[model samples]
Target: MPGAREELIAHITEKAVFHGDFILTSGKQASFYVDLRRVSLDHRVAPLIGQVMLDLIAGVPGVSAVGGLTMGADPIAAAILHQGAARGVPLDAFVVRKEPKDHGRGRQVEGPDVAGRRVIVVEDTSTTGGSPLKAIAALEKVGAEIAAVAVVVDRATGAREVIEAAGYPYLAALDLADLGLEA
Candidate 1:
């Protein structure tokens, strides 16, 4: 049997990859698209994603929480939180809204307080890296030390370069090649 990461890759390739013309969040055109939500939200695949992503961010030290921009990172963070607990890792999850709420404490970052804690920003897939960077900005305001930026699928666009150029370590569990696709 394949290991968790390999199994997760198989699931993504079989279920999430779509061919033909597509437009990405980055406003770029592509011949293929990786819709990780298709599998990331699946019952069976969620745990696999949790396991694979846990392994992906394992090396980053002092990580107390995982999260990113709300919509895409929501399920991914939940997966990691559950899987990390199952493995005795004791991880927490947070959410970064696109804008601070006008009501109810007027806060942007939600969940347990991340102040003075280390966090790894996560996303379902990365194209231009805007989502993670936006999350990072909010996290920083709340005093969360960003250990790294991680993604389940990297489209091999300029995201890595953009994140790394901004001085955060960029970690990706799978790339286009792993899904038998190309940039």
Candidate 2:
């Protein structure tokens, strides 16, 4: 897990997944960024990420499944489910919609039935942690027990306090400091 985390950190630093000063969702801007899909699409990083995330939250009690909001959670969930099967742990995966649909099945939670199951939300990066919290509300509304939350990187914007205040442990494989970017 440590090696995989290190590899991810190295990739992010060297590749510099950044561009011009851009406005973040929080309307704040600096000189750096991390478009995780770049790493998520890399076959090597993808699988290694799955292993690392799984290990990070393995000690969280329950955890029958894994997932988060659609686009961000997609790759992580798939990787974790696949690797979990390989290791014989067999975790289910699901996606929480940004908004509940009004047509067809009219579902907000997609993939598997999360009701009565223990779940964890995953994020590629967390600044204020709003995205995962939205998923958490949707999941718990459907009766899923949230055991913890994990992120590949913490953008150092009080995410830990926000999540912990809501009574969920926030786990991170790397913070900005680990990448040599101070909080």
Candidate 3:
């Protein structure tokens, strides 16, 4: 896992992270940014994300499914779902849209039905836990038992407290310190 950690950190540092002044999705300003999608969608690196994430969540006891908010969570969920299959473990994937689709079934939760399932929300990076927390709220509305919350990179903001305050364990594959960008 150390190797995986090192490799991902290097890949992210070289390809995804930017050291500069910018505003984040959460309306917060930062000296750096981590655009994990740069690496999350890559054919080669996606599996590494999946494997490392899957390894972290493997012992959660009853995770029948994994997913999170859209855009960012899309690839992470897909990769983990696929990687889980390759590892002889079947796990479903779901997405929590910004709002329920205006047409069709008009469901906010997409993909497999998550009702009564043990779900772990996933994300590419967590700043304030806003997006994943939104996903958790949506999933809870549908009766999905959130086993935990997982992130590829945790900026070590208040996300840990925010997520745990919502009553679920927060799991991070990497953190600001891990990326050598400790706050």
| Per-residue accuracy of model 2 over 92-161 as CA lDDT, tens digit each | 9998999999999988999889999989899888778798999999999999999889987778778788
Provide the lowest-lDDT 10-residue window in model 1: 174-183
Model 3 Cα lDDT, one tens digit per residue, 1-183: 467657777888889988989887778789999999999999878988998899899889988999999989999999999999999999999999999989998899998999999999999988888998899889999999999999999887789899998788999998887777856
lDDT of 1 by residue, 1-183 (tens): 789988898898888888999888778899988898999899999999899999999999889999999899999999999999999999999999999999989999999999999999999988899999999999999999999999999899899999999999999999888888878
**Best of the candidates, lDDT:** 1
Q: For every candidate structure, what is the RMSD over all alpha carbons to the true structure, in angstroms?
A: 0.8, 1.9, 1.5
Give the TM-scores of the predictions, in the order they appear.
Answer: 0.98, 0.92, 0.95
Which is the winner by lDDT between candidate 2 and candidate 3? Answer: 3
* TM-score (C-alpha) between model 2 and the true structure: 0.92
Q: What is the C-alpha lDDT of each candidate?
A: 0.93, 0.84, 0.90
Angstrom error at residue 29, model 1: 1.5
Q: Sort every candidate by TM-score, greatest first.
A: 1, 3, 2
Q: How close is candidate 3 to the true structure, as a TM-score?
A: 0.95
